[model samples]
Target: MAPNQDEETLESLLEASKTPEGRSRLAASGAVATTLRHLSASSPLTLPYLRLLRNLCAGEISSQDSFIDLSGPDTLASILLSSAASVEVLRAGIQVLGNVGLAGEVHRAAVWVRFFPDGFLRLARVREREVCDPLCMVIDTCCSGVGGRQRLEELCGTDSGLRILQEIIETALKAGYREEWLEWLLFKACVEEQRFLSLFLTLSSSEESSTNLDISLTSVFKPELLTTQHAFLLDILSKCLTERPKEVTVSGKFALEILEILKMIYNIVDFTTRVNAAIPTGSPAIDLFGCSLLILRDICAWEDARPTETDKDSLVNLLLDEGLLDFVLSRLEELEPPAIVRKSMVKEDNLFPVELEKRVCPYKGYRRDLISVIGNLLHRRKRVQDKVREKQAIPLLLQQCVVDEENPYLREWGLLAVRNLLEGNEDNQKEVAELELKEPITPPEISGLGLKVEVDEATKRAKLVNISG
Candidate 1:
């Protein structure tokens, strides 16, 4: 049969294998062995066909005899090992073997590890354009425990398996692949199954240079990819913090991960610097939306503790340099409450708590540091003025400040920054004055200025007026 016909047959078998009756029929019949034999042949098989057959053999077949009868389970394993199929097919085959749910088959999972040294590494070497989506799907599905937990254990135990996973991470750092995909794969391997947490720990411990991460870092800053991946990386890190907290220690590794994520956001302001960037100017609004959400999430994440001056400066420079201050401001404005006085909104239990808010609330020094960042950006020379339109920039930032003021500390900072802006520039000052004159001005009394001033001024005036009269 042609590879396409084989693929169709495999698909039919897989669909049929979904039911117990179908699975039993597959186990009882010779169809699976025939497919395995065909897969083992020198002739090329479509990736989908190989994947489906692998899945069906592992999942539907219950008896060791079914696999063992194909010249023994070892023979079937040899076919899988030698085929050197695409990562998707290999992963599918491994998963099927795992799904057999027989402890005796654990050795087959181990065989995959022994046979495919750096499976992920080889996959990574392939041009991402050629393999990224398929490889990603392979990682995604394989890590899903589609085969079973024992199978995962078998794979993880293999040195090659661990290396492959590490390669995936390294590739993610270098290739600038989608963080969501990486996160999904990692989460499945480490968090959901707990099979690859040790591998993550080992990789995190290894003294790999940041150079590997630089390409992806640079790519992410590109306007189009930046927003989407930035949000994705943030979500991934946040989930890691919550789900696999133990694997992610409070070491430099964790800090590095956080910093990498922050760099992506910081890079957004200058996304046009590279020659062949992923995110170009005039990208869709969805990109902006993703980028904005990521920034907000990061702000919320670090809202509590005081960031070191170095961290603060780096972040500010990135935001100011990239022209992201306007984007940040815009998000704040969008979150503002309606002017109508309505019932007080109560917090819903189902809603995830904003971890950033809680972290920021207690740290006065941190709040000051954040305020300084906003102030500095408000004053800095615009780097991409032509692209961003300076005339439209300050108002957008001011709107963010106004809207963000719902948090008392953020509100205070926003008001003070606005004050600095309105008072700092002659034009802004005039604008403020004009606006003030148009509206009623209610000034809060300056604290500690004595009522004695009012009394003494009145007495002195009375004395002078009486004498004059």
Candidate 2:
């Protein structure tokens, strides 16, 4: 056939695959499948043929029959595995398998294993730049599909499969593919998918398997890998701490589990320490209770909908805990200074240096000093609907703004901060009013000589004279 005729046939097949009627015709007739197989196997497969194959596999073709006679599974796999095909062709083939959900078909799966049993493992090791969206789609489909988990488990069980995955992980690490998407996939496989976790735990439990996994993870932590994966690892660790309550036992060993994971993923002790410290403190039982609340809060907040009553109650309880509350208050206070000082310095460096230098200053002065920072935090808290905590946080913050005689300029700021906090709470407003019971000073009157007179004394003297009269 002429190249133009072949192109036209390919386009027609693509169009047919896109609609239900056409798809049914293609799948039922098997003509499309025959054409696809022939075109795919042809030497120097043209781009048009490759596109048609992709469209067919991508489920653009509605017909299941279109897939039936498109070469035997083994033939299709062999064509894909052949060194003659380009990476684009291989990717198109994998995508077709994924989109068609053919991984569930035993015959197709057997062909897949026979021809490219290690294909995913190979793709996993490819350079980050080369690991395109189609590859990710293929991995996601296969790992999440029927028999995919079992296949992964089987592969992990084998020395060769394990070796291949290990190498791929190492390559991914080295090539700087530690973004959230990749980490999320790994997290899903390790935590969400029972088989993967089971296999991982089983392997890590054994001295030999543990050694190999460790070596693989270690190889993945080369400097470039560490740099790329650090934030993602931290994110994963935080999520694990928040979400994987079942995995974390109440015993100190759970903390150890976290530490172990952190050590394996990254070498940042400080980051791990911060996360560990963030874990609520109390008796293991109470700690578990509090952590559970935190976890619930995190999960509810993550979802699109509002949290249920149970979630709200848990968050409230967590927020109201004196120790936890105090910690949050302390953080608010700690965060208040740099903002005040930075702004104050920015506004008038020389005059504000004294207040800024002090390690402990009143919150009132701090606000005056760092209005921008406090405003920003308040904005964030408000955006997140933590108004109650934000209200509670203000007083503790204001106390830090108090100024002494040595730094009198801070007194006005201290008072202002107090006023701002008081304004937010009715009880605080009343308390503030009672604290400043003295009447506000009135302006003095101008005498006939055009000089101001002391109003308080003059009024008092006039009242006394009138009484005497």
Candidate 3:
């Protein structure tokens, strides 16, 4: 075919793939091999052609199968690494692989291996708005399963991956994007290399994290701080702590791990107030708090969603091994109770009830997560139940359940914590029974609207002026 005629023919084939009838015709023409062959040659239509392959593969099982059959993975990789192809072309090629990878494990593995033989994720211009969206989608999709997740570790071997992610995180926060996607990326990196957890913690916190803390948490992780053979925690958190953290291999590390997670959650949410201030609604401080709350929720849900196994330790013991309840309950001292709950009271049906429906500071999602953490721990642990009784947690839980009216969810969580404390342990139940769960009272209810007849009365000022004379 003539050059012009061949170009026209390829364009027609591309157009046909867009519609059902065209897909049928293109299928007969063996579209995958044809596109791959043409892709090998330099032409003006190369990027457009790659984009067409992306569309064709979407939502069509047959195209996905056919593309893989014709060695589409190799073709895409070549375009991605091509010195001759433009960045636009490489990106389109990535989308096609991402789409194909969605079919199943084989295709996903193929795409994953060939997609970034060079660790392009670290190289991609994630700061640019346009380049970021599709690349984020691709990375998220590629991390769809255990196999993909395992392969993603290879992304961390190169130092650039962490450095790039750090830059994006810091930059995005300054620009106020927060970039949840980048946070996830940083999280994945940390999960792979435990040292990066410290970095993730620093980045996840408000910018003031480094300068404002009395200890300046950043200083704790300096390379010089650790001995030459630095030993990180084998059990609890690797990167989530310091770069050169003390090794913790002793029994009952789980509770300690939970404590660390809780501590970080507390610092991030309480960032504004730690220095004697409150974060305003819709401000960046609150945004960081909400974001930190989401991270906490995600942590709980992740553990909750894990598949069950018979050999697992009792939930409460796993939670209580380090006297986890004591540490966490201690942490709650900084979490202030609701202001309105303290000040507000109302009369209803001859009863003065402290407002139960208004939520206060501790009713926020992060605190609910804390409640859930306790509830999850205490669900089946006799030891935790005993500790709750011993530590007198029943009263604390009762206060939350009684005073928090604004958050039904928080109220539910509080009730759950109390229920866990009360379950299966008669002595713990008895301890709770002895505590005073009182009714609210108003001054009117106490004084009963007295209507005393007035006798001769003198004001204080009059008495000072000798008005009696």
Candidate 4:
């Protein structure tokens, strides 16, 4: 047909793509195939046809279905990879790819695994802001897909794909566009895929154990490059620390696994400012540390009588080296009163505690969480128990158990921690036997003040008597 007829036909398709019913009718009449043919046959026709496909697939699954039914992506990918393809065609094609990938992971994986080998990744090299950002966004959304990390890593490992990806990440970060998603992708790729978490441990490992790490200067992954990525990671972490996480799971942990991984990246004890910022002033600090302690509790716990080191480097050891136990113990020491007061309402034991259990905890839930973390720490690792005993944790722990007998949760965890301390250790049992509990006696509450009868109508004078309860 003539150029005018081609223009008219492309215009009709573009108009049809704007509506669901129009797209369906175009699909039924094989108009999608006709458009794809025009896309490949006429270089002048590429942008209009690509625009049609992009609009068709934008929020409408049926339009994506119609495009997929015509094998539109392969045609687009082939055109994209061609050296003769114009910059405009490549730009339009990347947007269409993003739209298709957004349809779901299946379409995403197809586009990624096929074109990413050299097509789209190389397209990112284009310096045009319009093209560069859409390319990065396409990769970002694709990385979030089901098999994205694995496939992207495979491609990255083959040649300079990893470098190109890192470059893209750095560019996006410098431009300040969706840095968190970029950080997560980089983290998953490096930490999960490249096993860089071990490398990080080696880097942060204390000076004394430096000899045992066996890390070399000529390592597979360079430290300096990893440091650049880590700097961005730390930036993301600082933000999470300031605001209490809004999403939570049934077990009272952050809902996102990415945040969980970020948790493992660095211990909270070392970053006091960051950890303090993670919770509100009135909110208990226990929730922040409790989650980490719970994970450590699971790691160190044993089913049989024998405990095993689950990893080459124990997370518990990491916590220990970071002084996590000491931090919690010290914080508890700071928050604890000279005397824990239990009301004489229930005469359980002759501990001689104070009149009332003063409001020590900033929030209620923190009480149980703090003790539970400590209790779990004592359960498996004899090292932790030994440390606790050396730190004189028994007397303070016992006080918490008996001081507020009404706090069932605190009492339960405190009791369990005390039990774990004494279960297999005779020394701890003796220490507990020798422990002394004392509660300070406080003055009675002053009830009211009243005028006395000394003003017996003789002198209009008023006398006040103080009443006590």
lDDT of 2 at 227: 35
Error of 1 at 118 (Å): 2.9
The numbered model that scores best in lDDT is 4
Instruction: Decide which is better by lDDT, 1 or 4.
Output: 4
- Would you estimate the TM-scores of all the predictions? 0.39, 0.48, 0.57, 0.45
User: Candidate 4, which segments miss by more than 4 Å at Cα?
Assistant: 1-15, 40-46, 58-74, 78-91, 102-109, 127-161, 178-184, 187-227, 233-469
What is the C-alpha local distance difference test score of each model? 0.41, 0.40, 0.49, 0.52
Candidates 1 and 4: which is better by TM-score?
A: 4
Cα lDDT tens digits, model 4, 1-469, are 2334577877877887788788667656665556666677247777887887777677667657666767777788777777777768777888888888898877787777666656765675554555656676677677776777777666345334554554454455455553244444444444345533333334333323432224432341332223343344333333433232232111212212223432433332232222222222222223333343343344334333246665422544555665666755765664433222422223453443343433354333344545665776677567887888898776666545533422336656766776676666666655544431223211111011111112113323211223333
User: By the TM-score metric, which is better: model 1 or model 3?
Assistant: 3
Give a tens-digit lDDT track for model 2, residues 88-118.
6665665555565543455345444553446
Superposition error at 9 for model 3 (Å): 7.1
Residue 341 of model 2, lDDT score: 35
Best by TM-score: 3
Q: What are the per-residue Cα lDDT tens digits for candidate 3 across 1-469?
A: 1334456676776677788777666666666666667675367878768877877787567788888888888777666666676657766776787678788777777776655534454425334433444554566566667576665655444343434344444334333332334434544544433334344333333333331222333443333332111121111132232222222121223323333444444443333332222222333333333333333222322223223422234333444454556755664433554333344444453443554443235324545655666665566566667777677665555545433333337657766776666666677655543432223211221122221111113211100011122
Q: List the residue pairs that clash in candidate 4.
A: none
Listing every candidate in turn, what is its Cα RMSD in Å to the true structure after a full C-alpha superposition? Answer: 16.8, 13.9, 13.4, 14.2
Given candidate 4, what's the lDDT at residue 249?
Answer: 12
